[model samples]
Target: MVNDIIADERSPVSASGHAYGEAERREANLIYEYADHLQRHGHRVARQLIQIPGEPRPHRTDLYDTSTNRLIEAKGTLHREAVRLAIGQLFDYRRFLSPEPALGLLLPAKPSADILELCRALGVKIIWQEGGGFTESSGG
Candidate 1:
């Protein structure tokens, strides 16, 4: 089932992980893990590479599910400030990859309700850790 879902060229796990900054790379790994989790549940998952024209370079999305073609931007942090920063980054990514509604997953350290609310208002989906792993409740 997992193998079937990830049978695509854009799947993240299908290719080698990028060599981002230490912290960024760690966060990317977590997103990859979440993608693996979703794949285990029989969902097709892919990762997007976002490149804003005239920008510094391109940034990769946490995960993108082929089943739903849902673009997910993952944010992880122990501090509220860091989480906020991640949210901002995700928003930027969404804008760059406009037209497709993006989902934000808060891992380990969750974002505040205010941030979550903002995401809701902006039509960005939210997912977070509940127990042993993460779960998606909206933006299917």
Candidate 2:
């Protein structure tokens, strides 16, 4: 439901419609900052909308690198619950992308060691904000 909520947030609706709390808003800002950072690094970033057959609505991925087939899912935090949700989203988005790119997670900060381990086990690259740039963990 997070995706659905966020999708609504992109529209002109009541705050209660999206219902993203403070942490969620902060995380959304991080995604914007991350996208700008990537642009400065020469990576063309764009949102990818995935439309499933017979589905009335489509799902949107946060950022995708057109130059390099990389799909990125951004999170405000890499806490346990956020990571879990991101993993599911990355997988779902990947299936719909043409040529299915490599998947990555963008976070405001590095997560706990255990969470990083979980990402590695799932084969999702971890990229966290560092200073004004981003650091890649290349999770196992």
lDDT for 131 in candidate 1 is 76
Alpha-carbon local distance difference test for all models: 0.61, 0.77
Model 2, 105-125: lDDT tens digits are: 888887888888888898888
Which candidate number has the best TM-score?
2
Tens digits of per-residue lDDT, candidate 1, 1-140, equal 33432233343333357534555545655666677777778887765678788879566666777776567666555455765666677767767664655456546544566766666676666676667787554432
What TM-scores do the predictions have? 0.63, 0.84
What lDDT is reached at residue 123 by model 1?
65
Output the worst ten-in-a-row residue range by lDDT, candidate 2: 1-10
lDDT of 1 at 50: 80
| Prediction 2 global C-alpha lDDT | 0.77
What TM-score quantifies how close candidate 2 is to the native fold?
0.84
List clashing residue pairs in candidate 1.
46-64
Q: Tell me the lDDT of model 1 at 125.
A: 65
Error of 1 at 128 (Å): 1.7
